[model samples]
Every structure is written in C-alpha cells, then in structure tokens.
Target: MNATDRTPADLLRSALAADPARPLVTFYDDATGERVELSVATFANWVAKTANLLQGDLAAEPGDRLALLLPAHWQSAVWLLACSSVGVVAEVQGDPAAADLVVSGPGTLEAARACRGERVALALRPLGGRFPQAPEGFADYAVEVPSQGDRFAPFAPVDPDAPALAVDGVELTSAQLVARAREDAAALGLAAGSRLLTGRTYGSWEGLSTGLFAPLAAGGSVVLCRHLGQLGEEGLAKRVESERVTNSAV
Candidate 1:
C-alpha cells in the first residue's frame, strides 16, 4: 500500500505492521481433515525464521537458485516468501540439478538427490512436523527451523529489481512480481478484508498471482485447500459456508 512495498517481503511487512491479527492464510487438507490458520504476524514469524535458516545455516546469498519441489501447501508458501525475503530465486517445479539448493517433499527424494548442492526435505506432515528420521543427505526443515532466530534481517540488502521467482519458463523480478500481483488483485476483485477460497493446485503464474501475491498485495486473506477432490460437492459447500468465503477460484 506504500510506495516502498514493491516486493513480496515489503508487502508482508506492511500487512504485519498494519494489522498483525488479521488472518493472512488459512490452509486445509480435505483428505486429512487438517486445518491451520495463520495471522499476519504468525506468517511473518515463519518467514523470518525460514529466512534466517536460509541465510545463516544454508549460507544462501542473493541470486542463489533454490529448486522447490513441493506441492501446493502451507509450507511451500512459507518457502516462497522466505526466498523473496532473502532475495533468493524460488524455482518452483524447476530442475533440481541446476540449482544451488533443492527442497523436496516426500515423493521427490530421488530428484532432490541429483542436485549437487545443499538439500532440505520437508515431511509435509500435520503441523509442519519433521520426518520420523532425517532423510539421508538432506536437512530436515522441521528439525532446523525451530532453533533459528525468531527475527531476520538480510545480511545484504534485497534488490527489488533482482529476479526472485522462476517456474514453467517464467522468470520475474521482485518488482515485476509485485506489479503483476497488484493488477491481478484488481482483476480478481480482491480488496481489504476479502476472504478468498482457492484450490492449492495452481499454475506457476496463478500460484503467485491469485494464490499468494494478489491476496497479500490487496490486503485480503486466502483459504487454500489441498486434495480438494476429496471434498465432495456437499463437503465443499459446507466449508464455504463455515469459512464465509467471499470469493472462490477452484
């Protein structure tokens, strides 16, 4: 909302400072009956801790490419903002072998191992839990993130003009990401206090624009669902009624 909010991190900070108690993201897994809601402040805390881990433990610097081989889930959203906060490039569904770091979920272990850099694995369990045992040759995100500092400041300034995201043959600078998100916010009819329900499966652009970026840029909130097919039509209608979703994109 300010002139300086030209990047995802900036917009997040503004949201936190403006109304920390507002629900920013609510996640649900229809197959597992799992629900998690994060206020702006809570989400920011996760981003800060994750950023600290990326900068301090991983020694990742600006322009470092991180292959994000995770499905559309809450943890994936955290990693995306963590990369933006530290000016790292988040390559969702990208080639792991070409990246400086690789983050994989349960099913992508083999592909993640092909990456020649540091590897991190997320169990993608309930409550963002760690794996029962650490995956060989990979750091467990749940094991490492909790001990990281609660606050984060990038060692070097994050450049808004720098490339921040890459996926599906699309690359966007942080500034471009914000600009496009703003346009999408308008087109999607998202404004302050809007509550949007959306499917977790999104294309690269759709994921960034409507799923994460546009809601944040527009001062609204999102209710993201995974395994939506498991929620039958009746179940989905019940959810919409319970969550009071104002807009839906499924």
Candidate 2:
C-alpha cells in the first residue's frame, strides 16, 4: 500500500482500479441463510450512492458526527465508507443524542428514535429490501439510497487530517485510520489477493481492522460472517473449501 492512501474510500478506489471484477466483500448470515457478494466496482457503486444520500439529501457536512447503531452487516460497512467519502465523522455505536445523523439496524428503533437529528433505518432483509413500513421519524435507507446519484462528489474537499472515526473513546483522522489499517494488514497476515474470512460482530477498531480495512488496504478481500455460532465446524470447513478462503481469523 502507498503511504499516500488517506481514507478507507481510497483503498476501495485502488482495488477497483486494480481489479474491478475481483470480489471485495462477500457477506453471509448463518442464521438467515443469506449470502451476498460484491465486486470492487459494485461496492464502490454502493458507496457512491450512499455518500450522495448523506451529503446531498441529508446535507451532512464534514466533521459532522454520524452515530452508526449497526452490526457488522454489509450495509453497515457501506455506511462507514460513505461517511468517509463525504468527510463526516463515523462513530460506531455512539450516543445518538449527540450525533448529527443516526443510522440504525432492524432492532434499534428505540435508539433511533432517541436521535433528534436525521435518521435512517435499515431493514437488513435479504437483498437489502426496504422496511415494510417507514419507521416513525426515520427514512428507509434501502429506498432512499438507490435513488441518489451513482457518483458522489463532496461539496468541499475533505481534509485527510480531520477526525474521521470515533469508537470507545478513541478518535482517529482519515490519514491515521489508513495508516493504522496498513499496520493491521501486516499483523493479520493479509496479502494481496488473499481471501480472508472473519466474523462480523466486531464493535470497534479490532473488528473493523481485520474484517474490512485490513483486506482492503492489502488489496485482498473479505468474507464477513454473521451469526457465526449457527455454523458447525464441518459446515465452516466446507464453506472454506467452497469459497477458497485463503485465510481465516474467526
């Protein structure tokens, strides 16, 4: 990885340029029996659209804090990069009341409602479907994001040195985040083109580092597992063989 890489979004762009067809994030929910794979181009497209939703629709500006009350699902990952694209501060599982925007998953209605800022709710349904009905005081993310522009351009340039992520009382700038991810990639044994499988229940730096950032920074890919407890050892071994997973940290 280059020393100039500033944000997680930059890593995605690099991967898209290197191999657009290569799988980037392969998501699985053991309990729900759902699997979705995204190539570099496809993942970038989602990030672009979601970035537009955050900047254009929600008017989220640089330095604004977005409380992400979501698990390690693929959509949650998308939102994280979206925040980076638009230069908004992404705070994982942060206090909703203090945030400028709030994004919540299926069962976080109470916490979502506690946020007075702009709110978005994800159904986490198979195929990323919309909520059956709009959650009060919240916009349905699935319905809103796709209609936004396919390409995202921030209103103003994002300073790489500005705060980008906060979790568990720790804060890091975009530049710092990318630098740390590079360090983590080495520690996790991720190599270019490697396929790493990991669990998706990570709450802070450790989870984000190995599950998303490490592979991305190393020009590799991730197979993120949710509800992993439901998969037996034999089933996991079969999946590793079928998916050709090069490594695992689960």
Candidate 3:
C-alpha cells in the first residue's frame, strides 16, 4: 500500500504512452453494425475525457455511485477504463441486489424488484430508434454521463493498494496482481511483437491477467476471440503454425 505501487487505472496512462498508435479494442454490433476500433492514444484520451466528465462535471465525490450499462462492445470497454480512471463506484448490470445503478440496453430495463437501490438506464444505441422510454423513476445513463466531461478533474494519483476491479468474486488490489502478471510475463520469456491468442471470456481475474495484461506487459500482441471456436480450427491451426506462439497460458 505504499505510494510507489501503481494501480490498474494508473497503468492506463503508461500503456497509452508506450503504444499510443496500437489498436486496443474492437466491437461488432448485431451483424449490421460496422466494427469500430480505436488506437491506444485515442482510447486513453477517451478515458481521460470520460473521467473528467464523471468527476469534475458530474460533481461526483468519491464513492458516489454510477451504474454502467455498457454492453459487450468497444464503448463498454471505454466506459470501464473511464470508471477506473475517475475513481467512481461503477457497477455494471449483474447483481442487481448489490448494485446502485443499472446500465440497461435498448428497451431492456433492469427489473426493479431485483434491484435494491435507485436505478438508471444507459442505452448504447441511438435514442428514437430504440424501444421503451425510461420507466417512472429511472434516468437515462447516456444523457447523464456526457455532462460530466467538462467538470471532471483527474485524481492526484492511484494507490495500487486500492481496489481496481472485481475479480473472482473478490475485490482485487492492483499492486499484488499486476506485480504477479509482470513477473509471470517475464517468466514466459515473451518478447515484443509476440502474437498471443486469447479465449473469449476475459471478464474473470485469470482471464484479465493472462489474456489482457500479460501479453501487454511483455510488449506482445493479443488475438482476441469472442469464443475459442470463432476462429475455426483450421484458422487457429494456421495461426498457431505461422505465429509460432511460444507458449499459451490458457
């Protein structure tokens, strides 16, 4: 918990600084939506801007809650980074009982009976085309967040000892896990430009550590698959054959 250790959110600045031009995340919506990708620099700027929006503009004191309704898309990833950077209490829609805010998709409202607190809906799509207006009490998350952009000021520094994200049903402290990941990457003897293929489910602690952070720590590339099967066996076989992935952690 010393001042020296850097939290996961803190690491974002360094990651973006190191490889500002690299593509970070991509999303394909419902086959009709075009996939959008963002570079590291753009991603960082978006996060910083969002953090500023949440903190300075929103007048959100630390521990003030926000419900994030980002789906499994690039925007969700951006929101995740922004939440981490700004120190807002962000709970995505999962456990309604424990969450204070609910980020819902186009017409889907988080069930109030399941929720234990005040709820708001955040839509990821355009407004008019989307279905079902906000229920009686819930607010629109989309409209609420952008206002935060101008007012949010950056935090002084991140204490790695503080909670960065929830992992394996536990609140993971940034210092310990990141240290282990850095060390583990070194152990794997990975070099720069290594192409690392990752399984789809990276929401778990192990997945985040191995798939996202480890390869990045080693200055390697990560091949993201929504599912192991998405890349056909032949495709994966050829990739493995050509890329010469030295080792796989999964």
Candidate 4:
C-alpha cells in the first residue's frame, strides 16, 4: 500500500498512477453467463462519471448519507468508489428512510421509495444497459450517468477523517476504512498482483473487505462472482484457471 493513501479513493488513485492498464476488477454473473473486465483506467473513468452524477446532477454534498441497495455487481463497486471520491457516506443496504439519497437495483426500487430525497434506479442489465422504461419517481442511472463528465472534481475536498461508509450497522470513517482494508489484506495473505476470487455479497464488513477493499488495498485484482453457487465444482475450477485467480474467499 502507498504510505500516502488515506482513503479508498486515494488507494484507487495510487493504483491508477502505478498501472492504469492493469485489470482491477473482473466480474462474473454465473446465473447470466456474463463476464466483464475493467482495468484501473476504465474503472477510474466509470467512477469519475458516477461521481460527477452524484455531485453535479444529484447535488450531493459531503457527509450526505446515500443508501446503496444493490447486489455484488461491478456497478455496485463503481458506486462505492464514487461515494468515496465525493465524501458521500455510503450505507450498504441501509434503511432508505434515513438516507439523503437512495440508489437501488431493480429488485429494491419499491423499498427505496422510503427515501424522501433523490432516488436513482439501476436496471442491473448486462453491459450496463438502461432500463426499458424509467421507473416512476426515480432517475435511470445508466441513462443519467452517461452524460456526466468523464473527469470528476469534488466541490469540496474530502476529509479522510470524515465518515465514509456504513455497513452492517457499523460506521467507519475514510481513514479507518483504509486502515481496516490494509489490515484485512495482510490477514488474507494478499500481496501485489494477487488475484482474488470471491462470491461474497457486500452486505457485511467481511464480504466488503474480501470482495473489494482487501484486494484493492493489496494492489491486486478481483474476480467478483455473483450467484457462484450455480457453478458446479468443475465449472468453478475452470473459472479459477481461466481467470488466473491466486486466492479465494468463496
């Protein structure tokens, strides 16, 4: 880890500076037979656009609570980093009633209505496609995000000590999150260039650390699998080989 990295966004920036072309996230949806790979530069571009959408279009300010109701998909990862870039306090699977903004998947749009603030809905389609029709009372994320600027500059500087994430009833500041991620990476025996495969959801601290933060902090990449149980042992083995995964937490 870079000594100067104080937040998740900082870690990502370091990664971008070191190797922009290296694959950072390789996502798979076993149920749909979908696979997508994102290099550091590609991931950062997505984050920038999404951050622009959050800060510019949604008018999100630092410290505002954003309820993130999405599955363990690549887009979910993008939103996580985007929240970090803008200093938005991301609440994973949090109560919508307490959020200043809500971003939900197609499965949770009804539940997200409790948020009296801006609401965005993701169709969770393959290739990040937009919804066939925009859901009522919510902006379509795929549509709105594309028009956002490719480069993001937050209106105010993010504070490393400020609250950044709320997950599984635990709130962690950006600095604490970075420290925990580095610790978790060490505990998992992940080193630079280590490729981790995980089927874990992002609903708990353990899952979040293993699936996203740990590998990222370790200067490694992740093969995030959704509905991994559907893949039999033989298929899983083939995937591990094909993806060159060196570590696993499934």
Candidate 5:
C-alpha cells in the first residue's frame, strides 16, 4: 500500500497515476456469458461520473448513507468507489428503510422503494445499457449517469475516520477499510501487477476484500466472476489461462 493512501479512493487514484492504461477490472458473468474489461483510466472515469451523479444530481451530502443493493458486478465496484469519492457511506445490501439513498439492481427495486430520500436503479445490461423503461419513482442510473460531468470533486473533504462502508452488520471507517484491504492483499500474496481471480459475492467482508479492495490496494487487477460454478472445471481452467490470472480466491 502507498504510504499516502488512506482510503479506497486514494488507492484507486494511486493506481491510475501509476498506469492508467493497465487493466483494473475484468469481469465475467458465467451465467450470462458476458465479459467486460476496464482499464484504470476507464474505471476512474466511470467512478467520477457516478460520483458526480451521487453528489450533484442526487444532492447527496457527505456522511449520507447509501444502500447499495447490487451483486458483485463491475458496476457495483464502481458504485463502491463513487461512494468513497463523494464521502457517502455505502451499505452493501443494507436496509433501504433507513438509508438516505438507495441504489438497487433490477432484482431489488421493490425493496428499494423503502428509501424516502432518493432511489436509482441499474439495468445491469451489457455495455451498461439503459433499461427499456425506467422503474416507477426511481431514476435510471444508466440514463442519468451518462450526462454527468466526467470529473468529480467532492463538496467537502472526506474524513478518513468517518464511516465508509457497512456490510453484514459490520461498519468500517475509510482508513480502517483501507488498512484491512492492505492486510488482505498481503495475506493473499498479491503484489503490484498481480492478477487475482475471484468468484466471491459482495455480501461479506471477506468477499468484498478479496473481490475488489485487496487487489486495488495492492496495485493489482481483478478478474471478478459471477456464477462461476457454472463454468465447470475445464471452462474455469480455460478462463484462468486466458485471463492470465496469478492468484485465485474461487
């Protein structure tokens, strides 16, 4: 971990500075036969746009709680970093009733209605396509995000000691989250430029650490796979070789 990095956003910025063209996230959905790869610059651009949406369009203030009801998809990772950039506390699969804002996938719109502040829905379509029709009372993230500014600057400086993420009933401050991520990267034997493949969900700390944060903190890249069990043995081996994966947490 960089000595100057104190938060997930800082780690991402460091990575972008080191090699913006390097692959940052390579995602696959074995269930859908979908594959997408994002370089560090591309990923940061997405994060910046999403953060602008959260901060400007949604009128999100620092310390606001955002319930993130998405799976371990690439967009989910974008939202995670966007929340950090805007100083919003991201609650993975958190209860919408108590959230100041809710970002849900197609499968979770009904539950997302409990949020009184604001609601956004993602289609999770290939190439980040828009939903054919927007869900009632919710802004379509794909439709709205495209017009947002490509650069993001938070209204106020984020406090590293403030709450940043909550998952599985555990809350972690930004600094603590980065610290844990670095520890996990070391434990996983990750290094700069290492490629880590993971088939873990984002419902637990371990899964989040391995699937996203650890690799980011270690200056490595991730091959995030969903429904990987469907790939079977031979297909999985082919993916490992094709993606040039170095470490795995499947």
Candidate 6:
C-alpha cells in the first residue's frame, strides 16, 4: 500500500485502484431488506457524480454552507465526499436554514422546517426507493436533478487553507485537516489496512478528524457510526474483535 500526503479525493482514487473490488461500505438497507456493499469504485463514482451535481445543480458557492440532515445511510457518504470535493462548508448537526436549502431524510423535514421558518429554500429527498421516505413539496434528489453525466462538471479549485467545515465557531481547512491527520497517523504508527476507530463520540472535532481524514491519509479503513445509539457496548466489542480494529486513535 503506497502512502503519501494527498487530498481526500486523491486518496480515495488511489485506494480504489488498490482494491477496486473490495467493499468500502457494507450495511443492511431496510428498503432492500438485504445487505448492500458499495465497492470502492462504485462509491467513488457516486462521489464524483454528486460533486458534479453540487457544482452544477445547486451551483453552490464556495464558502457557502450545505446542511446534510441525512441518516447514516448511503447518501450520507455521497454528501460528505461531495462537500469536500467542491470545497463547500458542511455545518454538521445544524439546520439548512443557514444554508440555501436542506438535503435531508423525510422524517427530518419537519425539524428542518422549524429551523428554517420560511427562509430555507428546499427540503430535498430521494424520489424513488424503499430507502428513505419522501414527504410533500420534497424535491427528489434522484429524478429532479439532471443526469450525473449531464450535470458533471470539474471540481473547482479551492484554497486549501480556506474553511472546509465550520465546527464550533472555528473553521477547519482541508489543508490543515490533511496535515493534522498525516502527522497524527505517523505519530501513532498507523499502517496500511489498519482498521482505525474513533475514540471520541460523533460530532466532536476529534471524532470528525480521526474518523474521516486519518484513515484516508494513512491508507487505513474507517468504521463510521450513525450515533452513539448505533453501536451499543456489545456491538462495539464485537466489531472491534471481528473487524480486528487497531484503535490507533485511542
């Protein structure tokens, strides 16, 4: 496994080449009633398409916020990656009223509405699929938008030091995050194929940095959690034992 300093996009592309056929995300979809494993290449393609759409459909401006009220399901992966590629700011755990619109699950639209209070532009959800339910006035993310190819545009250049995520008032930049991860990973003696787990809970700075960038930088794997509820103590013990997690972030 070749390791080096690279953008998250660059790292993902490299990792896909390393194990294109390998499953990057494996989960059971309530809609499908079966397990789904999104391969590295497939996930990367969606990310690229979503990035293009974020650039084309929303025409989202850099430094602007994009609120993701998604479940820790498939689209969440796309949302995070697309935001990084486009240099758009993700205000995690926040409402889209701060943004032009909210891309959310059907269940969360009501909460989004309360947060928005008429200023929010849209509450978008997937049109078809057993995956997530869609309520009225919802713009279907699937059917309503142009084809990925049709919407496909290049990822615009970003100032690496510019704010990529607004977390607790301090903006974290792509460059700074990347640098921190690489430095920390090296210090921790993390290696390729190392199954790294976050020590901190989700939504914390430590959690975001460790779970997201550290693995990408170190050529390792990350196990994302929905909320603390998703991983009970027994599940946690089992996952660590089963996945052979290194727990380098600890």
User: Per-residue lDDT tens digits of candidate 5, residues 175-224?
Assistant: 99999999999999999999999999999999999889999999999999
lDDT of 1: 0.90
Q: Candidate 4: which pairs clash?
A: none
Q: Backbone clashes in each candidate structure, one number apiece?
A: 0, 0, 8, 0, 0, 0
In model 6, the runs with Cα more than 4 Å from the true position are: 1-6, 26-36, 71-74, 114-133, 142-147, 150-155, 187-189, 198-201, 227-235, 248-250
Better of 2 and 6 by TM-score: 2
TM-score of candidate 3 on Cα atoms, chains taken together: 0.67
For residues 25-101, write the lDDT of model 2, one tens digit per residue: 99999998999999988989999999999998898999999999999888888998999999999999999999999
- Candidate 4 lDDT over 140-184, as tens digits, reads 999999888988888999999999999998999999999999999
Error of 4 at 12 (Å): 0.6
Which sequence of candidate numbers ranks them by lDDT, best first? 5, 4, 1, 2, 6, 3
- Model 4, residue 91: C-alpha shift (Å): 0.3
CA RMSD of all predictions: 1.0, 1.0, 5.1, 0.6, 0.6, 4.7
Per-prediction TM-score to the true structure, in the order listed? 0.98, 0.98, 0.67, 0.99, 0.99, 0.73
TM-score of the candidate numbered 6?
0.73
Q: What is the clash count of model 6?
A: 0
> Worst lDDT window (10 residues) for model 5?
1-10
lDDT of 2 at 14: 84
Q: Of models 1 and 5, which has the larger TM-score?
A: 5
Give residue 71's error in model 4 in angstroms: 0.7
**Which prediction has more favorable lDDT, 2 or 5?**
5
- Candidate 5 runs further than 4 Å off: none
The lDDT for every candidate, in the order shown, is 0.90, 0.89, 0.54, 0.95, 0.95, 0.60
Q: Write one digit per residue (lDDT tens) for candidate 3, span 45-90.
A: 6666667755554544444445554344445555556666665555
